[model samples]
Target: MSRAKSPFSPAAVLRGALVPMLVVALWQGLSMSGLINPVVLPSPVAVVERWWAYLLPPDPYDPAQGSWFLWALSGEMLFDAWSSLYRVVLGFAVGAGLALPLGLAMGGKPRIYALMDPLLQILRPIPPIAYIPLAILWFGLGNAPAVFLIAIGAFFPVLMNTIAGVRHVDGIYLRAARNLGVGRTTMFIRVILPAATPYILAGARIGIGTAFIVVIVSEMIAVNSGLGFRILEAREFMWSDKIIAGMFTIGLLGLAIDIGMNRLNNHLLRWHRGLEN
Candidate 1:
C-alpha cells in the first residue's frame, strides 16, 4: 500500500498556490470580456508586456534621436527598489537599537518612566507625515531625511512594547533569581531578558511593518532615487503599468520582510510555542 503524504507535503503548497491563480484568471477573464476598460484596467498581459518593454528597452522604433524612452539607469525600477530597501533597513535598525535599550531602562526603573512617558505621549501622537516639513528643514532632502523619517516611524512601537514586556516579566521568576543570590546584572540578563523575548519579537514585527509605510512616504518626499520616486515619475509620464509595478514591488518587499521577521520571531520564542498557533 502507498504511504500517506505528510501534512507539510508539496500537495499543500499546490493548494496554497491555487487561490492566487484563480484570482488572476478572473481578472484576466474580465478584461478579455470587455467588462473592464483597457485604459483603466489593463489586462495582466498588457502589464507584463509593458513591464518587459520598460525593463529591456530597445533601439528606437521611430527615427527621432531624442524620442522619449525609459532612462537607462534611473528608470530601471529594481534600482529604485534596492535604494529604498537599503534606507529602510538602516532606519529600522537605528529605531530598534535605540528603542530597546531605552525601553529596558524605563521598564526596569520607575524614575526613568516618569521622565520619558510624557515625551513619548507627545511625540507618538504626531504622525510621520506631519513631521515632513520639520524633517526637511532639519535634514534636507535625500536619503538622510528619508531614513530619519523611517527611524521616527519605527521607534515608538518597539519602545512601548519593550517597556511593557520588561515590566510584565513574571515576578515569580525575579524572586526565584534573587533567592538564588543572582546579581542585578545577572538577574536582568538571565531572568528578565529571556522572559521578555516574546514581547520584543512582537514589537519588532510591528516596527518593521510601520517602517515600510514610513520609508515609502519618506522616499516620496525626500529622496529622488527610490521606488516611491519611480512611482511619481511614472505617474507624470502616464505609465500606469509602471506605476502599478512600483506599488506592487513595495508591497511584495514589505510582505517578504514581514514573513522573514515572523520566522525569526518563531525561532527566538520557540519556548513559547503554540502561544501564537
Candidate 2:
C-alpha cells in the first residue's frame, strides 16, 4: 500500500539538483583557491554570467547583414539553439522513418534479415564521425551534411532495437492472435506493434541522444550556425567563458530533449506498465 512518489515532487527536484550544485560549489572553491587557471577553466559564476549575456545580447541588427542566415550567425543564442534543434529533429525523423520500416521487414522475415545484416554489421562498427568527411564532400557546407551525420548516428540504434522488439514480441500474444482468427496484417498491426512499442521507444530515446552528439560534432566542421559552431568559434577566440557557456547550453538542450522523450515514453507505455503490474 505504499504510494508512488511523483518525479516532479520538490524532494525529487532537490535530489536531482544536489549533485550538480555540489560540483559547482567545488568548482567555485577551486577557482577562488587559484588551483585552476581561469583561462583554461572559467569559474561557474563566470560561465553563468557569460551564459546570461549570450542568452540576452544586444541586437546585432544591420541592414547590410543581408541574408537571414548571416543574421542568425551573428552571435544569437536562440538562433544557434534553434539551428541545432532543427537539425536534430530533421535528422532523427529521417533516420527513424527509414529504420522503422526496414527493421520491421528484417525482424519479421529471416530472409531479409540474412540479406541485410552483414552489411549493417560492417557499417555499424564504423563511427558516424568517419562519415563526416564524405558527408561534407557530398552535401557541402550547410545543414545537409550535419543532418546526414546525425541521421547515420540515429539509424543503427533504432534499427537494431526495432528488430529486437519485433522479434521478441510475446509468443503468447502471437498465438492468441492467430487462434482468434486474425489475419497476418491484422495480427501484426494490432498485436505485434503494440507489444513491440516499448522497445521501439527505448531505441528512439537512444537514437535522439546519438543524433544530438553527431549534430554537434558535424556542426563544428560542416556548418556555421549551431551551439557546436559557437563553441568552436569561442575556442578560436580563446573566450573560455563563452566556451563554457556554449557547453552548458548544449547540455541543457540535451537534457530537455531527454526529459521530453522520457515523458513521451511514459505516456505511450502506460498499457505496458499496467500489464507488468
Candidate 3:
C-alpha cells in the first residue's frame, strides 16, 4: 500500500520557504555590496520599502523622498484593486451563469451538443486579446470593455468543463435516479448537479484565472486604474522599485484568490478526498 501525501506538512512548509528566504538574503547582500545597481535590480528591502510606502504614510526622513499624500497610495491601490475585482467577478459570474445551464443542456442532449460543438470549437481558438480593439470600439473603453474582455476570457473554460463533467457522469447514477421515480427537475438538481460539481469547480477555477489575466491585460490598454495600469505608469517614470512592488502586489493578490478558491472547492468536495490531498 502507498502512503498518502500531505502537502501542508511541516517539512513541506519549511522546504517551500527555504528557497525564497535564501533568495531574499542573496538579493539583500548584492544590493548592500553594490554588486548590482539598485536602479537596475532593486533589493528586496527596497521593494518592500516602496510597497510599504504605498500602503502607509511615508516619513520625511525616508530615503525614497516626499512626505506623501495622507492615504493617496493606499487609496489608489485599493481603488484599482477593487475596480479590477468588480469587473472580473461581474464578468465571471455572467459568463459562468450562462455557460453552466447551456453546458448542462448540451451534455444531457446529444442533438444540442452536435449542433453547438463545432461553433464552440471554432470560436474557442480565438484569443481574448484579439478582441481588445473591437471591445474598445464597441464598448468604448473603461469598465465595459474591461468586463467584456474578461467575460470572453472566462466563458469557454467553464462551458467545456461543465459539459465534460455532465457527460462523464456515471450511467448507473442516471439509471438509478430514473428507477427511483425522480422527476426531471429533481433529478438534475439533486443528482446531476452534485455529480458534476467537481468538473464545474474545476472549470470555475480555470475561468477565474483567465478572468484575472484578461482583466490585467484589458486594464493596461482599455482602462486607467488597475495593477496593470499602475505597472505601466511606473515604467514611464522609471521607478524600478515601484514597478517591482506593483508586480508583487498583483502576484500576491492572484495567489490569495487562488488559495481562497481552492479552499472553497476542497470544503465543498470533502467527500472527494483525493482532491483535498
Residue 211, model 2: lDDT of 96
**Alpha carbon lDDT at 171, candidate 2:** 98
Model 3 local distance difference test score: 0.86
Best by lDDT: 2
97-193, model 2: which lDDT tens digit per residue?
Answer: 9999999889999999999999999999989999988998899999998988999989999999999999999899989989999999998789887
Clashing pairs in 1: none
Q: Write the per-residue lDDT of candidate 3 for residues 136-219, one digit (tens) a residue.
A: 999997889888888888898999999999988898999999999999899888999889999999999999999999988998
lDDT of 2: 0.90
Which has the better lDDT: candidate 2, or candidate 3?
2
* Alpha-carbon local distance difference test for all models: 0.82, 0.90, 0.86
Q: Clashing residue pairs in candidate 3, if any?
A: none
- CA error at residue 83 for candidate 3, angstroms: 2.0
Q: What is the TM-score of candidate 1?
A: 0.84
